[model samples]
Every structure is written in structure tokens, then in C-alpha cells.
Target: MSRALLIIDVQNDFTEGGALGVDGGAAVAAGVSRLLEAHPDAYDLVVASRDWHDADNDNGGHFAGEQAPDFVATWPEHCVAGTPGAEYHSDLATDAIDIHVQKGQGQPAYSIFEGTTPDGETLSQVLADRGITDIDVVGLATDYCVRASALDAIEHGQHVRVLTDLVAGVADESSASALAELAHAGADVVDSSVVAA
Candidate 1:
């Protein structure tokens, strides 16, 4: 079975010192890079996603606007398209990525599955076209994007594994709960070390 690596939202805004930064986000970036460099052939396809929201508008109420951001359904303005914040973190080696996905163009998007490639192909379409049957998920904000992406991958009829060490989250409790939920949903929650190149 073909395997793919799904790197979710390892962007500047999600890393330390940016809007909605998560603790250990930068480490996840570096770790992911190392994984790809060390296992160049481990995955048939390497895909990375970023939050590319529209700067001119609230992105369909995704941004809190005049109201304070509740950090739940609404968030502060971040990762505007063409901005540095929307770019992937420097620590993540983008040269290794075969596909780059941009999500939340003008709406609230948490999963990479909600994104599209430069060619306008959906992630599911890309995977199906490539015959990718197994996926290894890793990246920032585990409780949000990583969690959602893995669940969607499972729902899409793909085998999924979440590399715990390669992800960071917004909070401790929520991240733990999200991991538990993923495990319950049939995703193998494990460390990147367990994966063989």
C-alpha cells in the first residue's frame, strides 16, 4: 500500500510568536523536517498545508471582527494570504513536499482535507489519483487541524497514523482528548520514531 505524509498547518501564525501560536509548534516543524530528511523514501507523497485566509474580509465570520475572538468558532485575524504568517515555518523543509495545500481561503477551515492544491484539486482527489492508501499525519495544533484531518482521512477510507511527537497543540487537556478521540476512531496514535524509513 502506498503511504503519504500529511503535514498540517505548520505555518508561521501557528508557530511561536505569531497569532494563535501554540506551544512546541516550532519543534514540530523542525521534527517534521528531520523526519522527511531522514526518511526520504518513507512516503510516496509528502503534502503540507497552510492556513491561507483572506485579508480583506473576515473569511465568513471565521475572524471575530468587532467582537473579541472566542478562540472557538472565531479567531483573530491571522495567516492572511500572501503574508508571511501564511507561509510555512522556516524550520519545515518545504523542498521535500510534493504537494502544497492552502485552506480557509475565505472561510473557517481546520482540516487539510478542506484545502486544495495550486491546481485546484481536493486532497481526497489527489490521494485517490495517486493511490495513497496509508497516511502519516503530523503538524501544529494537534487538537484542531491534525485531529480533524486524521478523522477525515479515516472516513475517506485510508489507514491513518498520527505521529504524536511531531505535533503541537493549543492546549494540554484538549490535545490529550483529541488524541484519545483519534485512537478511538481507528487512528494509530504513536511516535514518529516507531516509523521505519
Candidate 2:
């Protein structure tokens, strides 16, 4: 099985002490690193994504403006390009990543599919070129980017598995719902241990 590991938004701004910090983000980063360490051959490709939003504007309404952020469609200023907050978390093993993707540069992008690599190749193209048929997703905020990424993976005709234990989320209630939705949408909501196994 050709599998790709998609690490979504394990960035500074989404970790424990940054702008849109989510609980357990650090643990997820470390867990993913350990997974890769234990199972180096588990994935044919390793892709990590970040919310590299532009600093000047609201990023096509991805950020709040005239009113308070509803925390759903709009959020507070975060992950601005060239900022430390836009960088991956200290605990995440970014060195092992084969492809790096930056999204939300000037628009609202929830799926990694919306991102392009440094060489300007789309994520879907990368997956197809590499012959990746299965995808294992792990990272911060299970209710948001991680969820979107997994669902999109399924939509793109790939087998999707979400490393539940290797992910954090914005809230318990919403995160639970997101997991349920992902499962219903045909994703395998398994734990990180499954990767090691």
C-alpha cells in the first residue's frame, strides 16, 4: 500500500501558547515524530502544511475585521508569513518532511489540496505522481484543518486514515463531532499506534 503521511498545521500559532493555541498540540507533534521514528517506511511521502496567511489583509475574510471573530469562518490574526508563529512547532520533526505546503496565503484554504509546493506542484499532483493511494493524516486542531484534509483526501479518491491520538483540537465537543463526521464520510479514525503496527 502506498501511503502518504499528511501533517497538517503543526505550527507555532496552533500549539499550546500561540495565537490560536489548541490543547495537546505539543503532544501530537511529539507523537507524530515518534511514529515516524518507529516506522520510517510506513509512508511513501511525508507532507506538512501550515497556515501561512498574508500579514497585510484579512486573507479573503479568513480573519475577522469589523466585528469579533465568530471562530468558525473567521479567525483572529494568526500565522502571518515570515513570523515565528508561522513556523512549525519546535517538537515536530519537520526535517523528515518530504514536501512542505503553505496555505491561506491570500485566501481561506482549509484543505492541503489548495496548497502548492515550492516547485509549484499541487498536492493532488504530488500524490498522483508519487502513486500514493492511501493517506494517514495527523496534526493540530482535529476539528478544523485535520478534518478538512482527511475529508478532502477521501474526496480525491484516496483511502484516508486519521491518527486520532496524534491530533489536537479547538474544543472537545466540536472535535468529537468532527471525528464522527470524518468516520461517516469514509475515513478510518484510528489511533497513531496503528501506524506503528
Candidate 3:
């Protein structure tokens, strides 16, 4: 089984001091970087997802609206296209990334595989072309994009393992519940230590 690391949204906007920052997001990046360094050849492919949303888009409005639900409307504007916030966190090992998938180009694409690329190929197709079977997920808010990407990977018939230590969430309870849900879905929820081993 060829393994790949699917790093989800380890962007500046999701880190501390940025809009919609997750708790310990920066730490997640650092941990992921270390994991990648420790297991340089463990993965056949290394991919990263970025939340690249438009500045004046409906997705932005979804969070800014008055009638938006508490969970949905709570976050401030983040990851706007071409902004520094949309860029990957500085701590990540950029040289290790073999593929870069930019999501939320128009709307809020939670799943990295769902978004289309500039070359008209989806992330899943790109991975499929490379014959990637095992996917190790990491980064960003574990309750949202990370969870969505892992589930999507399972749906696409890829064995998924989430590096729990390399992920942070905006809400503790929700993140814990999401991890449980991922486990229930048959995805392995392991830590960086497990990856390092």
C-alpha cells in the first residue's frame, strides 16, 4: 500500500493571531513538520491543502451574516485569496510537499479533494493517478477540514490515518467528538509519535 500524507489547511489564517484561529494551530504545524522530518521516506506522496477563498464571496458572508448559526457565524474573515493568511504556516516543510491543493476558491470547500485545480484536475484524481492508497491526514481544525478530508479519503477507498497531535480545533468538545467520529468511521486516529515510529 503506497502511503501519502494529506496535510489539511495548515494556513496562517487558521493559526494564532489570525482570523478564525484555532487553538494550538501553530503547534500543530510544528509537530507536523517534525513528523515529516522524522519519516522522510515513509510517504510516497506529500500533499497540502490550503483554504483559498475569495475576499468578497458567499462563503465570507456565511460567517458574517447575523442569522448564521453560532457555529457557522462565529469566525471572522480568513484565508482570503492571495493574502498572507491564506499561505501555509511558515513552520511546515514546504520542500517535502509534492502536491498543493487549494480549496475554497469560490465557496467554502471543506474537503481538500473536492476543489478543482487550475489544471482542471481534482485532488483525488491527482492522488489516484499516483496510485496512492494509504492517506495520513494532519493539520488545521480537526473538527472541520481535517475531518472532512479524512472522511472523503475513506469514501474514495483510501485507508486514512489522522495524526491527532498535528491537528488543532477551534472548539475542544467538538474536536474531541470529531475524533471519535473519525474512529467510528474506521479511520485510525494516531499521534505523531506513532507516525515517527
Q: In lDDT terms, which candidate is top?
A: 1
In model 2, where is the ten-residue run with the lowest total lDDT? 188-197
Q: What is candidate 3's CA lDDT for residue 117?
A: 64
Give the higher-TM-score candidate: 1 or 3. Answer: 1
Q: What is the C-alpha lDDT of each candidate?
A: 0.94, 0.92, 0.85
Scored against the true structure, residue 77 in model 1 reaches a CA lDDT of 95
Which candidate would rank higher by lDDT, 2 or 3? 2
**How many pairs of residues collide in model 3?**
0
Model 1 gets an lDDT of 0.94
What would the per-residue lDDT of candidate 1 be over residues 89-173, giving only the tens digit for each residue?
A: 9999999999999999999999999999999999999999999999999997899999999999999999999999999999999
| TM-score attained by model 3 | 0.92
Residue by residue across 1-197, what tens digits does model 2's lDDT show?
69999999999999988999999998988988899988988989999999999989999999997779999999999999999999999988888999999889899998898888889888999999999999999997899999998999999999999988998999999999999999999999999778767
Clash list (residue pairs), candidate 1: none
Estimate TM-scores for all models. 0.98, 0.98, 0.92
Candidate order, TM-score descending: 1, 2, 3
User: What is the C-alpha lDDT profile of model 3 across 1-197, one tens digit per residue?
Assistant: 89999989999989998887888999988888888788888999998889887776557454454554566534456788899999899998888898888887666578888776677689888888999989999998899999899999999999999988788997999999999999999899987676656
Q: Mark the regions of model 2 whose C-alpha exceeds 4 Å error after superposition.
A: none
Higher-scoring candidate on lDDT, 1 or 3: 1
Give the poorly placed runs of model 3, Cα more than 4 Å off. 60-69, 73-75
